[model samples]
Target: MRDIALLAILLWIIFEAFRRPWIGILGWTWVSIMNPHQLSWALRTMPFAAAIGGATLLGVLVTRGRRDYSQSREGVVLILFMMWISITLPFSMVYDDSFELWKRVMKIDVMILLALVLLHSKRHVMLLAWVLVISIGFYGIKGGAFTIATGGSYRVWGPENTYIEGNNEVALAVVMVIPLMRFLQLQMQAKWGKLLLTMCMVLMASAALGSHSRGALLAIAAMTLVMWWRGKNKFVTAVGMVVVAGALLSLMPAEWWERMNTIKTYQQDDSALGRINAWWMAWNLAKANFFGGGFMIWVPQTFAIYAPDPLDVHAAHSIYFMVLGEQGFVGLILFVTLFTMTWFTAGSLRRQGARQPETKWLSELGGMLQVCLAGYAVGGAFLSLSYWDLPYNLMILAVLGRRWLDRKEWLKEKPEPVIALPAWLRNWFRKKPRPQALP
Candidate 1:
C-alpha cells in the first residue's frame, strides 16, 4: 500500500512535469531530500529517484519544455567543476570506488542543469522552496517532537542512503532550512499560514539542537544569529528563540553537553583528532597530486602516506579540506568560485530588488538564501557534505532569482495601456468631462 501510494505520487509528478517543466523541479527535489521510499520496508529497494529522473527527462524531451528558458553563467562553472572531477577520477587512488561517487554526483548535476533550464519565474522559485522546506520540515517536526518526548536522548536521522542519513548531517540540513521556512512565513499573507510556518521554524530548531551534534550546535547558533539580525519582530523573535533554546537545552541530557563540550576540548577527543588528521591528509594530497586524489581521497593508503596519525583513517569532515583533497588546487578554486559566484549573485540581486517595490520578494528571498548559505558555511566546516543537494538547490534559486529579476516583469514597471472608452461610456464621458487636460 505504501509502495502503491509512492508510485502514484511518482506518476502524478511525471504527468505534472510533462505539463509544466518546473513541476519536475519540485518532483526531484522531493526525492532528493525526503527519500520517501526509505520509509517502507516493502518499497525500500525501489529505484524511485532514478525512475522519476528518467520520466522527467522523457517528459521534458517529449513536451519540449523550457525552450525559452535562459541558462545562467553560474551553471557553466558547475559543469566545469563536474568535468574536471570526471577527468581526474582515473588518477584517484580508489578508481573503482570513484565511479559510483561520480555517477551520484552526475545525477545531482543533471538536476541542477534541469533546474536552471526550467525554473524561470518567481512562482517556480517559491514552489521549489516550498517543496524543500516541507520535505525537510517533516523530519524537523518529527525529530523535534521526538526530542521533546525522549528528552533529547535519541538522535535524529534522515532517510537511509541520503546525504543526511546521519544525526549530524540531518541536524545541519535542518539548520539550513530554517531560513527558508522563515522566508515562507514572510511571504505568506494569512494569519493561520504564518502561524503554522512559525511553529515549523521552532520545531526545526528544536530538532537541530536535539541531534546532539557539536557541529550542528555551532551551525544552529550561527544561522539563528543571522536570522535574528535580519528577521522582523526582532525582540519577540529573539525572546521566543531564547525560550525554545532554553527548553531544548534543559531537555538535553548531560552526555549531550559533554559531547558538545568537546568543541572546546577537541584536543582531547579522538574523533576530533581523527578529523584533524583527515584534514591534514587532504591538504597533503592536494600538495602531492596536482589533480588531487579524486573523491574519497582519504583512503588507507593516502592516510598511511600523508596523515599525522596514519593508524586512524577518517573521512575529511571539513568541506574546504574535502574539496582540496578530492579535486586538487584547481578543482578547489572552481568549487569555491561556484559558491562565491552564487553568493555575489544573491547580494547583487537583493540590492537591485530593493530599489523596486514589486520585486521586494526577491530581496527577501536573497536575504534568506544568504542565511541558508551561512548555515552551510559554518556547518559544512565540520561535515563532509560538499555534494549535498540542499545547498546546490539554494544556489540554483539564488542564480535563477538573479536572472529572472533582470529579464522579467518583476523589475520593469509597465506603463498602463490607454484604451478608447466603450461606445456607451464614451458618449457619457464626452457630455460630462471637459476639464481633463490640466497642464
Candidate 2:
C-alpha cells in the first residue's frame, strides 16, 4: 500500500508536470500537512528518487532519440575536478571514506541529469515550481510543529536523528518561489485561484520565519526588496512590505531576541572561539595538503587532533572551509567557477528575457534561480550543503538552460495567426453542407 501510494504520488507529479493543477494540490497536501518523518524514512529505504530518474531517462530517450555523450562543459569539468580532488587525497586524513564520497557524488550527478531531462517545457517548469513550493512548505510546517511541541527548544526528526538545524536553505527555497507565485497570480483570472496562491505565499513566508535561520531571514529580505523594486505597482509593493515585515517580526522570538542582544558577548565565548580554532586548523591543513586531504578527511582528523571526547566532534561548519580543508585551493576554484558561471548565465538570461513578455515566465524563473543560487552561495559561507544539496540545485540550473533553448527555438519558428475557428471550420468553404434541411 505504501509503495502504491508513493507510485501514485510520482505519477501525479508527472501528470501535473503536463497539466499544472498539481501545484495547488501538492501545496495543500505536502506543504500544509507538515510532515517530513515519512518522507525521510522513504528516502532512506526506497529507490523513489531513482525511479523518478529512470522515468525521466526513458522519456528523454524516447523523445530525443539516443543520449548525447559529449566532452565535458565548464560545469561538468568543474564537477569532475571536484570529484578527483575528493578521491585523491595525499594522506590518510579525517573522514577519508572514499566510497561514501563517491556515493554522494553519484547522487548529485543523477539529480542533475534528472532535472535536465524532466524540465523540458513550460509545463514542466510549472510542475517543478509546485514541487518545490509544496516540499518546502511541508518542511516548514513540520519544523513549526516541532518548535511548538518542544516549546521553542531544540528538536530533530527521522531515524537518522538529524537535528532540525534551522538552516537558511529552507528559507532560500521558499523565497525563490515567491516571484513565480506572484507571476502566476498576475496571469490567473479566477478569484479563488488568486486567493489560493496568496495563501501558499503566506505559508511559505511563515515557514521561513519559523525556521529561525538568520541567513534565511537575510536572503528573503534581499529577494523581497528586489521584488518590490521591480513590481512598479501599489498592490505588489503592499504585498512585498507585508511579507518583509512578517518575516522580520518572526525572527525576533524572545530567546532569539535575547541572543541577538548579546551577540558580541556570545561571539567572544567558547562556541565562537571553537569555530575560529576550527577555521585556523582547516586553513593550515589545506596549506599543507595543497591538492587535497581527500574526501571524508576532516572528521577523522578533527577527531584525532581536537576531540577530547572523540565522539562529539564533526566537520567544519562552513562549506568553503570544508572544501579548502578536504579538497584544497584547486577544488575550491572549480566549485567557485561552476557556481559563478551559473549565476552569470542566469543573470544574462534574465536581462534578455525582460524585453520579451512572452518569455516572462522564463525570465522570472531565471531570477528565482539566481536568488536561490545566491542563497546557497551565502549559506555555503557558513555551512557545507554542497554535496547532497548540489544536485537539486544543478537540476534547477539545467531546467533554466532548457527553457532558454526552447525559447530561442520558438523565436526562430514561424508564428501562427490567432483565430477563434477550429481546423474543420477553416476548411468549411471547400466542403459540401447538406445536413441543414434535415436539422
Candidate 3:
C-alpha cells in the first residue's frame, strides 16, 4: 500500500511537473530531505528520486520555460567546473565508482539548472528556501522533542536511510537550518509566528547538542556567534544563546565532555590519527592521478597503495580531502572556486539589496544564508557533504537575486517610503518655541 501510494504521488508529480516544475522541485526536495519513502516498507527499493528528476527534466523541456542563465562569475565558474568533471570522469582510476558518481552528479546539476531557469523573482527564491527549511526543520523539531524526552541521554538522528542518517550529520544539518529558520522568523509578521520560530530555534539547538557530535558542537558554536552578531537585538540574542548553550552543555555526561575534550588532545586520539592518515592518502592519490582516482577512492586498495600507514585506513572525513582524492587537483580547485564564488555572490547580493528599502528583505535573507554557508564550510571540514544541494541552492538564490534586481533596474534612484515621525517632533520647531516662551 505504501508503495502504491508513493508511486501514485510520483506519477502525479510527473504529470504535473511540466506545467509546474516548481512543484516537481518541491516534491524532489521533500523526498530528498525528508526521505519519507524510507519509512515505507513496500517502497524502500524504488528509484523514486531519479524517476522524479528524470520526469522533471522532461517536463521542463516540454513546457519550454525560460533558460537564460546569469552571466555572473558563479554561473560561468559552475559550467567550467561541470565541464571539467565530464572530461575527468572517463579517466577515473576507479572506473566503476566514477561512473556511478557521474550519474548522481548529473541529477544534482539539473536541479541547479532548474533553480537558475525557474526562479524569476524574490517570491520564487523565498519559496525555495521555505521548502528547504520546512523539510529539514521537521527533523529538528522531532529531534528537539526527542532530546527533551530523553533528557539528552540519547543522540538525535535524522530519518533513517538518508544523508543525515547519523547523529553527526543530523547535528550539522540542524546547525545549518538554524539561520534559515531565523530568516523565516524575521519575515513573519505576527507575534505567534515569532514565538513559534523562536521555539523552533531553541529546539533545534538542543537537538544539535543531543547529537553528541563534537564536530556538531563546534559547528553550533560558530554558527551561533554569527547569528548573534547579525541579530537586531544583540543583548537578547546573546543572553538567550548563552543560557541555552550553557544548559545543553550541562546536560551532557562526563563521557561526552571527555570525547569533546579530545579536540585539544587530537594527537592522542586514534580516530583523529585515522583521519590524518586518510588526508595523507588523498594527497598522495592526487599527486599520482592528476585527474583524480575517482569518487569513493578511500577504499582499502587505494589506502594500501597511497596511505602512509596502510593498516590505519579511514574515510576522508574532510570535504577538502575527499574532493582532492576523488576529483584530483583540478577538481579541488574547481570545487573551491564554485564555493568561493557563491559566497561572494551571496555577500554581494546582501550588500546591494540592503541599500534598497524594497529589497531589504532579500538582504536579510542573504545574511541568514551566509550564516548557513559558514556552518557548512566549517562543519563540512569534518564531514563529507561537499556536494550537498543546500549550498548549491543558496548559490543559485544569490545568482537569481542579482538577475532579478538587474531585470527590474532596482539600483536606479529608488524612492524611500515616507517616514511617520511623531507629531510632537513635527510641531516641535514650528510653534513649540512660542508656547515655551509664553509658559
lDDT of each: 0.83, 0.54, 0.79
Candidate 3 matches the true fold with a TM-score of 0.88
Clashes of each: 0, 8, 0
Model 2 scores a C-alpha lDDT of 0.54
Local distance difference test, candidate 1: 0.83
Candidate 1 local lDDT, 1-439, one digit each (tens): 8778887887787767666656776788898888887887777787767766777777778886555455566788998988998888989888878888989999998888888887776767788898899889999999988888888888888778778888989999999998888888888899999998887777788799888888889988888898798767999989988987887698888888889888998999999999999998988888999998887767788899998888899988888899899989998898888888887888787678778787888888888888888888899999999887888998888987887787775645344323234589877867864577778
Candidate 3 local accuracy as lDDT? Answer: 0.79
lDDT of 2 by residue, 1-439 (tens): 6656755766654444233322223322232222333444353355434444444444454554323233224447555765666455445364437556656566545545444433444554555555555555555555545554554444222213222233454545455556556655665789999988776666566555555555455666566656665556969787758965655455445865554344357565554455555666667767777665666665654545543434445556566777776677877777777677776666665676667777666566666666666656664555555554432444355445545554574565454442125678778856876776655
Best by TM-score: 1
Give the 10-residue window scoring lowest on summed lDDT in candidate 3.
Answer: 412-421
Residue 139 local lDDT, model 1: 95
TM-score of 2: 0.71
Q: Return the clash pairs for model 2, or none.
A: 31-138, 94-297, 94-298, 94-301, 95-296, 95-297, 95-300, 96-296
Off by over 4 Å in 2: 1-4, 10-37, 40-44, 51-74, 86-96, 117-119, 141-189, 228-252, 262-266, 303-314, 390-395, 402-407, 411-439
Task: Give all candidate RMSDs, comma-separated.
Answer: 8.2, 7.1, 10.7
